[model samples]
Target: MLNTPVTIIQPSDGWRSLDLRELWDRRELLYFFAWRDLKVRYKQTLFGVLWAVAGPLASMVVFTFVFDKMAGLPSDGLPGPIFYLSGLVIWRYFANALSAASNSLVGNQTILTKVYFPRLIIPLSSCITGFADFFVALGVMLVLMAYYGILPGIAMLLLPFLLLLTMASALGAGLFFASLNVKYRDVGYILPFLLQLWMFCTIIVPYSEVAQRGGAWRFVYGLNPMGGVVEAFRWCLLRGAMTGPGNANATWILLGTGVPVALFILAAGLLYFKRLEKMFADIV
Candidate 1:
């Protein structure tokens, strides 16, 4: 009689033992998760994908009026609509990805309890659904850039890296929250309020405004990963035309400072998630 083969399953030994090979082999599962999320996002919505475009458009109008007209905030020299829209494009992607990823494991508790795949796939895949909305909103940003005669230069090539940075920052932060949320549940309530404060600290206001306050505030501003990303977005799309000469170096400084901080967050989040990954099946 031929012996039937049996496989053994075990938890990974260390934080560094992420099993990248397994993750790569199971890449198709990631695609399915992302597709399911994309479909579900618009499942019953009347506007469907147009909600992606509408959201940024509506925000641009309000931000332009409130910040530009009422408060007289500086947009470097860029027009108010385009300025706000650029930041909005990046901010919206990060916000949506973070929100979804934080809830991903809990929301899929049935699958968490029943099946096995790279648990990392759940949070990683959750970040991808927002890219659809991101691209849709980006089209609107392009139109605004054309209207304002802002021709992107060689710097535009860096847009992909900027987006990758945004994704990294979101995934890193989301991983930490996703793991905590499985146990705490308060993350669901706290995340919305947290994002509101986070947005205010990003390029919602010119980084120059924050710099004026002094070194201490500038240091805090530099620590926010999204702040550098938003400024970098404007630099890439507007060719440094978004800020006056004085503020141009400030954008570079923020970018310089934010990259390392973002990487640190990714590493820290990964470590925390791995530490708790074993408990997810039992507790969740």
Candidate 2:
């Protein structure tokens, strides 16, 4: 009998660079993953895709009444509905995407155990699933804009950049939490409360109020990744007509402070996720 040669394979160290080429090579798999998530989201729902915009629409109404009417919070110069909806559109997407990504690993545990693929694809697909909702909810913003007589301006070109920032922020935080969640299921419980607090600190309130606090508070406000994203979205879609807190300089300041923090988070998340990724299969 002839002896057959054996080939040995080993898992790479956790600290290595991500294989982007491999991810690209498996692009079709990513598409299927994203499609699976999207279908699962609206599957068996009464309203189907309409459910996507419902939450943000309802939140806009409640916020307009409570913040704009009851508390008398200013919306810069823009109308309350437009201002709130503008921020809500972006906020809702980030919140939903972040939650989806955070839970992705545990949610897809069966696939993780059965197959070999880039673990990042799971969370990345979760992020993609939110785009459907994002675009759907965006229509609500347009309707509000028409009602309020707001039009897209030159700044509208910046929307793609703002969107990219939102994606990065969501994925960064999501990866960090998703990795932790595999070991500590408590992350799922804590996420809702954290998101609520995060929203209040984000675009739920007018930026003017945060700016008024001055000193370190202003700097701190800029540190919140979504703060800049919300403001930038408002600025772009509102035609730069927002006054006071919406001034060009202030928007730049928030972006200046917030962008770096977002990028830093992305870097940190990638490092951490890669470090622990090898263990996920065994652990999960």
Candidate 3:
């Protein structure tokens, strides 16, 4: 009897051919990775989980103090803290996730060289870790909502879609930056400056009503992706305010344009990452 040898196809030494379904098949591993990341983030910190809750909460407090009080910004006449925190939750998730994903490939160099899993999954798992923190923040939001004596509208039922939108936006950008950072270490250096600019771009510190009244700002504000997200949050939560108009058609327009832009950027980023992934282990 003769022994036969089996042949197999291996992933190219490149990142271009990222297979979503194949990654999905590795769903068990993905869950494990996500859970592991969550554990790592909170493992030895002094505040532990409060560190997660405090980030957005602290930012919200500062914004409410300065933007709403000193700057005299309006929150569509809703409680400034409530309004700003809602927007902050979405913006913080996206910014934090994008930053983490951008650095993931470099940080996990050991795993990349030793094992073979989808390279894209590394950054993707980073972003999902933020999603785990999102619910923790949501619990704080419930307390804030009660403190403000505001009732959420039927639109509150749409929270899932909004959450999905934030996830997609982060992951789309996450994939882009992750791939880019592998080739250019400069991507990491520039990320903070970029997010700082992104911070002012979104009405995170102050709500959109303050933005709309600044005359020229209203139009320029439309350029930010989170504009629509913030508006929807207000509509869902702040409809009872004296000047509150809830959401606007403009937000719908941003949502419409943003979804495609995010997908386009993600696809292009994936392709670029795949092209450069071949060189990561060697140069990194």
Candidate 4:
């Protein structure tokens, strides 16, 4: 009997596995990428890492002028610079992370076409770089606190959770945008504008109390994940609770909702990313 020739076959589909574990297999790449990002970020700048610290410090001065002096917005008894800088630190980290992470895939198209590592690591590493700025902001905040003689209470313990939420939200949004960007390059163009609008929504300069006062929007605005984070940061670092009664149910509830929503968005983004990833070599 004549042997039948074997025919290799494959599926024609728009999706594949995310292969997140592949990150471990390429941990070296992640470290190198992260190092490269940190180096390039500070190398040419004369100010070095001071550039990171300067952003929040400069913004604090601006908010002190615009909101505190011009608009007469209350700082809720916290020093104006400290109040504004708290919000600025969290917002800056999230904004930087979301912006850089969203472009990680498309920005490195040559790598996408050549060898392979977990694509998520590209964005994840980029996001990690933003924390350097966050730490700088934290140091500045502490110095301002000392200058102002403000005492941060036990509420400050909540700071880490708020930071975690900010990161989760940024990562989720980044993944969704990155996936969309790979298919439609225009999304990449619009991302900066989108993040700017998002920055306002997070109450970066003005307090969330102002954002909530537009009526019925209190709860709806809480849907903005950064809303909870900014509010929580203030509560924790200001040595007080949300209300005079020392209760913080609002902060907790908002964080509860925002964290899960962020996670869901991340999961959905992964699915979407996998679905479109196969075409990157061709289209990108």
Give the top-scoring candidate (lDDT): 1
lDDT of each: 0.88, 0.87, 0.74, 0.76
Error of 3 at 254 (Å): 2.6
* Model 2 score (lDDT): 0.87
| Structure candidate 1, residue pairs in collision | none
lDDT per residue for candidate 3 within 120-217, as digits (tens), equals 77888888888877788877887898887877777678678877776776776777787777778999889999988887767643334544577566
Instruction: Work out the TM-score per prediction.
Output: 0.93, 0.94, 0.87, 0.87
Q: Decide which is better by TM-score, 1 or 2.
A: 2
| Over 4 Å off, model 1 | 1-16, 246-248
- lDDT string, candidate 1, 204-268, tens digits: 68876788899999898889999988988887788646546435587689989989988998988
Off by over 4 Å in 2: 1-8, 11-14
Model 4 C-alpha lDDT per residue in residues 1-284, reported as the tens digit of each score: 47986754476486776665666778888888878888888887778998888888898899889988888876656667877888888899999999888888888889888975667788778878888889888888878888887778988888877787778878878877887887788987798898778876675433445444664576676577787778777777875423332236656766676777777767777777677766667787
**What's the best-to-worst order under TM-score?**
2, 1, 4, 3
- Candidate 4 minimal-lDDT segment of 10 residues: 239-248
| Sort order, lDDT high to low | 1, 2, 4, 3
- Using alpha carbons, what is the TM-score of model 2? 0.94
Candidate 1 has an lDDT of: 0.88
**Clashes in model 3: which pairs?**
15-274, 16-274
**What is the overall TM-score of model 1 with all chains considered together?**
0.93
